[model samples]
Target: MKQKLGNIFGIISIISAVLYAVFFSLSRKQFTETFLVYSLLFLCLYAFYKLSKHAFHVNYRFLSKKWSGRFFNSDVLVLVLAVGVICRLLLLTYTPNLSQDFFRFIWDGNQLLAGYNPYLYLPDEVMRSGASPIPNAAFLHANMGELSSGHYTNYPPLNQLVFAAAAFLGGKSIFATMLWMRIFIIIADVGIFFYGLKLLKLLGKSPYLILLYFLNPFVIIELTGNLHFDGMVSFLLLLSVYHLLKSQQIKTALFLAYGVLLKLLPLIVLPLLFKKLQWKRASLLCLAVGAIVLIGFLPFYSSDLIEKYSGSVALWFGDFEFNASVYYLIRAIGYEFTGYNVIETAGIVLPMITFLSVLLIALKRKNEIPEVLLSSIVFSFFVYLFLSTTVHPWYLTIPLLFSVFTRYRFMLVWSFVVFLSYYTYSNSQFTENLVLVGLEYTVVAAVFLWEVIFFDKNNLQKTKLNSL
Candidate 1:
């Protein structure tokens, strides 16, 4: 029996190591390739299933030692860290296949080094006007895709700082710059692991739950494998939360300042901090975070910054629509009735609704404890995501991180199936298959209801919602 279990563990380790390569090398072009992507997703899901089950059933009996704490086994903790590091390091130099966002990342970095605020320059205009040129202007502009080339960059100032460093250090080599960016993201993931461990310990959940964030293949592919700086934002957000839990308001404000400057998701959860600290302190923290964000924007401060940034963000809510759930359903209704897209209207209303919903969550919940605090925050994000017009796969990582502290496993289900959205890129036109999108969300909704509603003390097995 022990031999069989040990062999299962060995097989899991080997399979995960091998698949990390396949995941890194995957190309997104669809025709004649759907089967491979689906197969890879299936195998990855299987790995998650087996590891989660093994972690629970054996309860780390195999990794535990006399000196280990009642909750976490340090040996298993090392195993989790090793897997995350090895998987990411293997993809360090590979070009991102599943996303072209990295091209824009490289372009932004090089643009910053060219004595221009990346936020202010439209890449397409640079090529057309022949302005102070970025080296390899044609190559970067061409590869960054028309949509990105035509738009003013929405990436915040702190992110641009990292890009400028990569550009400075990497010289003219795109791949070299990509290497530096990947290194930065890998370091951020390591921070996520460390702070995540401290959080799980503080919350009194299984420390192994960090695997849900670090070991998940989708996280590896989207954040590390595809060179998205959402990884960096997530790390800072985790650090901020850890400080908040420790009652270090000044430290929390500083970390959150950088996090919100990198991306807006951290700011979305800011009100939740009110649940942890007193009213006066929380107000001060909010002001501090805001002041820092304004200071961060000051260097790149342009008359166009606020207007251009808000317009760019407005595109996601009104102009852009992809892999959305409720928004799609609403859009279809509008098309049937008004014979036009309702995104302009829906975008205006949905965000208003999401704001009130999240505010209600933070105010109504007793969240001094990590479990409730994170649970309310994750659920608020669920409301936000379900109503969002654009739900990228990487967007799920924050909720997935928080859900670990609570009993919710819906984010786990969403992560596995979210890969289905990549099928949109299979054709050149970038059209999502509504059927596949339907299948994906139906599974998600079912699992969500099961975990949140149906599962209880006498019915833990009800999580056959396919989570563990």
Candidate 2:
């Protein structure tokens, strides 16, 4: 018995070591590095993750030792979290390699600290006028990419406020600003680790499932290494749902509104409230959320804020395309018929489909119960991404949060294959290979279909199969 537990513990340690090495490598490697190297390392990291997950479940489900045992579960949980933090600390000082969005992050932050509205001032115009308004404006404008430099920042007010705080604390040193920002992100991740565990337990799930998100290589790389704040958004979203399930309506409204201010994506889940809380309570919740969101935006309000922000967002649908699934097929068909890219039409149409799909899922799915509500939220996000004209890799963080509560595993699968879309960055043209895109989506779609169609007989949820 000791030997068996020791072996499982050994596997867990080995998984953590490999994850450390993988993140160390990713922090040093640029996106321009060969796609083969990125794919190989990511695939290898994922293999260990799967192995560790299997080992964990096998030890818990079959062994006489209770995975719920206070000492055992506590030690393993600490090991999982300590590794997660160690992996993040390794990249705390490194510049973001996977995305240049952080350059714009600092740009926005400095703008706020400098008393300039990020949404009102365009980086390109700020630079061309020979005015160095923001600290390190020259370097930031040069590297923030033409697409971002030309437009007003679309990051929400709370997000920009975070950036502002970093800018104020970091002074003129980009590394310092980055460090502060990374610290915030890491703290948010830690919050997610604890809240996610609590939420799983509240949902009657095995708390061990939080490891699926906490220790994911994809999450560590994207959210921590790349300095994206989707982790913060995820944390807030989780808190909102946690409180909502406990019938703490005011707390739920506050957290959900904060999440919406951080990133408007959480708005999609509002439809679920109608079914779960019913029309009257849900309507009041929506009104409360709306008031909070309005207050968040009021501090930075201007006539141009809405128009500029909406136009910048519209670019994602009308002008940009990447890692898309159904929209790509529809795009190819449009090309065949009209000999022109139809993102303009598809962008408008696909969102309508996504909204209606969300409505259908919210209304049709059995969501009055907490478990079904959680799963229904995941299903809606899946449909939204399925029909979205643009699907960034970090966008998967939403569904990944729900996987701990539900049987859906496609989010984990997608996290692995989504790196294939990075093949475009390997070259100067930054051209996406449709073949890689198709292959990535094909695997994700297949797994999604299978998981949605069939429940795992031995699903390591909250079930007790002690007689087995």
Candidate 3:
């Protein structure tokens, strides 16, 4: 009877996945339709969870043996991954639905291919001047919106290179450009799957644990469907850690640098490596990583690079506030006292706090073991996000990927609730629903606290008992 119920839930999940693809492909711009798609996607995820739970409970030994089998085995693990790949491929045929960020990516890529510095001019300035060097400059400028058009491109150098490759291959068509970008992200995701499985095995965990990341609808939708480069960042990060675990210090340092070049967030993890290596080896790794990062910046190096990039990045702290957790609470308190928004102060102070917190975690945690290092990374990023002024849905990808290695599953819960952040885009005013934001973070925070407090305590007790 339990097996039958599990099978039924699995069928429902598959159907929901297909329906989600259909609706997503048909009307990406319609909020109501998009919401329906998200609803179905979440249902699919929930059903899968139930199916797995019930199946595991019904026949523990059989399910364990089946899931623990090799990659080629005819097991549910293979089936889940196959379904995930199909969902991504189906969405690949459609243009980016969730965000227009890809337009900026294509625009930057075009600028690079045309031998122009993407950082040198704002899109609005270039369009207004009518002397834009990029092909289809007018079209790209119009689509990227005033907010993005007014800011200097702040994407890191390696990201620009990926953009350039896509633009060179896709030419002037938006669909073609999106296709190329999706292909890169999908390939990167495949790399993540390969290394994720290997790392799981090396850590003495079930390889099936990889499905938490690889089969995650949030990852599939955000990275593949929306064309966010966080997927590449996740891939490089996992590969770097895999190499680190294997004691390949040079390869680890090189890949870590590459990950940093893709997204600056990875720089926070450098301190965590200190406890994992000897002082001399750590210094050399740091120097090598620094040199590689500097090399990536050499092409776009200029007197104004620092000024422009810093200015653009500063807007996130001072000017923008969205779906923040602890920062929002602080902002409220400040506003109650000052009769004005206090983001300016909170922005500066919170980042310093986050930096200090990450440093503390790195210094305090025993990161020599792979599992401990992964947990540290997860905790550090959690601190970063909790204190951030802007917690975009895709930003959760880092912690989500890392959490699969640790016993904590709170990040998975965050991934599901993080979709609520997209509710902001449902209206033309771009008005935020603070209630939804609160609910999202509240649930995530509750789960996080439960894991860190109750779950960890119970696990510690079990460990002590087993040792006895």
lDDT of candidate 2 at residue 271, scale 0 to 100: 94
Which stretches in model 3 have alpha-carbon errors above 4 Å?
1-16, 23-33, 49-74
- Winner of 2 and 3 under lDDT: 3
lDDT tens per residue, model 1, 1-468: 645654676666667777667655557875336446545745754665566557565655454366445434544566667767987888887888877888888888888887888877788888889874576778888888888888888888899899889888889988788898889999998989888889988877777778888887778888888888887898888888889889888899999999999988888888788868968889999999999999998998888888998888788888888899999999999999999999999999999999999999888989777778888878988989999999988998788877877888888888888888988888888889999899989999998888777775436565565576
Question: Which of the two, 1 or 2, has more lDDT?
Answer: 2
Candidate lDDT scores, in order, read 0.82, 0.82, 0.84
What TM-score should be assigned to candidate 2? 0.90
RMSD per candidate (Å) reads 4.2, 4.4, 3.3
The full ranking of all candidates by lDDT, starting with the best, is 3, 2, 1
For model 2, residues 1-468, the per-residue Cα lDDT tens digits are 646755765665565555455545652234434344545545545554564566566654333445445544544565567667887887787667678999999999998888888898888888988976787788898999998899888899999999999998999999999999999999999999999888877877766677788877778888988889999999999999999999999999999999999999999989998977889999999999999999999988999888999999899888988889899999999999999999999999999989999999888987888988998889888898888888888999988888768878888888888988777776678888899999999999899877775545445342556545
Colliding residue pairs in candidate 3? none
TM-score, per-candidate, Cα-based: 0.91, 0.90, 0.92
What residue pairs clash in candidate 1, if any at all? none
Error of 2 at 303 (Å): 1.6
Candidate 1: C-alpha lDDT: 0.82
The TM-score of candidate 1 is 0.91
